[model samples]
Target: MTEQRKDILDMLAAGKITAEEAEQLIAALERDQAPAAAGLDARPKGKVKYLRVVVDATDNGEPSRVNVRVPLQLLRAGVRLAALVPPQALVKANASLSDSGVPIDLTQLKPEQLEALVEHLDDVTVEVDSPDATVRVFCE
Candidate 1:
């Protein structure tokens, strides 16, 4: 348990606060600490330590599986580093991505926006399945 949580419980045990108040205080504390705790992978419940991508498929009647775990911090750092790229390079990259049918524009990817997106990704799970293969992306 975190010190904040422990303190809240202690107060409750001492009748310094009612059970309902303690519950509210704990919930508030958890909410406030969620982002930092998630980044550090310190919380047990709903904490994502890695970005995982899994693929399972059959090729010519043979089965194959690929599993990958990437640290979320790496992605955050990459996004922040993108700000250092030359504008011309970003423009070219954006054009290439558009040509490849990925409609995203790299020039518009700000670090702050990426940080927000990554934070939101903690609760996101994506899966795609077809007759011969399945792909899954999630945080864990």
Candidate 2:
């Protein structure tokens, strides 16, 4: 473990805080070290959990790079935002994106998520595989 993690553990062992507090601290530390949006907290009632999606393409046949286990909520939100670009405009845009190899339906995202999606769309490559609902957004 790193020095910071060790310190947190030491604090825990010394009874400076409860296990729950220690857990939250550890999670926050991990989140800080991870890539943006790498950690997701628990969703409220009627929300999703444990959704996974993997989006990858080969660059030289040795498995270029991959992003796995993305949140369904994020994907839903992005598609939702794409819904606001005027129905005819959205239709044209979706048609333009038809060769991206993933099936995307833009009208099902929540309002808040849709807002975030519009900003994220330019930076992501979305993928959804069969038998699961998660989405993979491979960043270029």
Candidate 3:
């Protein structure tokens, strides 16, 4: 449990707050911290550590546009295959991603899910600059 969670529990145990209050506190904490790193594979696959994934997409002659907090593993895989995508193979590639753990939910992905995602992605790199908690996918 996080220090904040422990503190919340302790407060409830001491009757400083009611159970409902404790639950609400915990939920508040989660929500406040959720959006910044919310995504499957946000952390290193299989670990509870906090992380974030950002996706940068570019179209013909256009500058890149980014989607933040994308699933680290899924985006890792997608970028790899997307670079060499044969137009008709996108669906198959995404299905393969489903096998890895990209979780259609997009909130978080288990390690197994990340592994599943990796298996389907043809070529991609997952880089972690820990201080930043961001994963950058280079589609080539």
Candidate 4:
């Protein structure tokens, strides 16, 4: 444990802060220290808690909107669970996805690689606008 973490724990033990506050402090410290501690690139790998999609549109002179928020933890769990799937099932799933124009290989979805991709996605925001609607996809 680092000195900062130890100090946070000590504060928690002394009732100087709540458990929730201690957890937040620890998480913040880890995020700040991760890049330097890993000895890899200096890029920060922050955990994404949610994947958000928002759409605003005008339909026949009436305004409409759509909002979707998906917990990223579910995605992580799904990737980990995929390892238990049979190879034949994975092949069939891949075929189905390809048929639906997804063009993704399910067998290649390693959790570590997915985590790295999600980390990069933290800085990405995609937006599209058409005559009728505007769509946005981002991580938070």
TM-score of each: 0.64, 0.28, 0.31, 0.55
Candidate with the larger TM-score of 2 and 4: 4
Task: Give one digit per residue, the lDDT tens place, for model 2 in 32-129.
Answer: 87754344433233433334445455545554444455455566665665556776775666666676854565444456766565446444565665
Best by TM-score: 1
> In order, how many clashes per candidate?
0, 0, 7, 0
lDDT of 4 by residue, 103-137 (tens): 99988877688777765766789999999999999
Off by over 4 Å in 1: 1-45
Q: Clashing pairs in model 2?
A: none
Model 3 lDDT tens row, 31-95: 98787667643744533222244644445656454544444465556645545545456566566
- Model 2: how far is 136 from its true place, Å? 10
RMSD of 4: 14.4
lDDT of each: 0.89, 0.61, 0.60, 0.87
Model 1: how far residue 8 lies from native, Å: 34
At residue 5, candidate 3 shows an lDDT of 96
TM-score between candidate 3 and the true structure: 0.31
Which model is ahead, 2 or 4, in terms of lDDT? Answer: 4
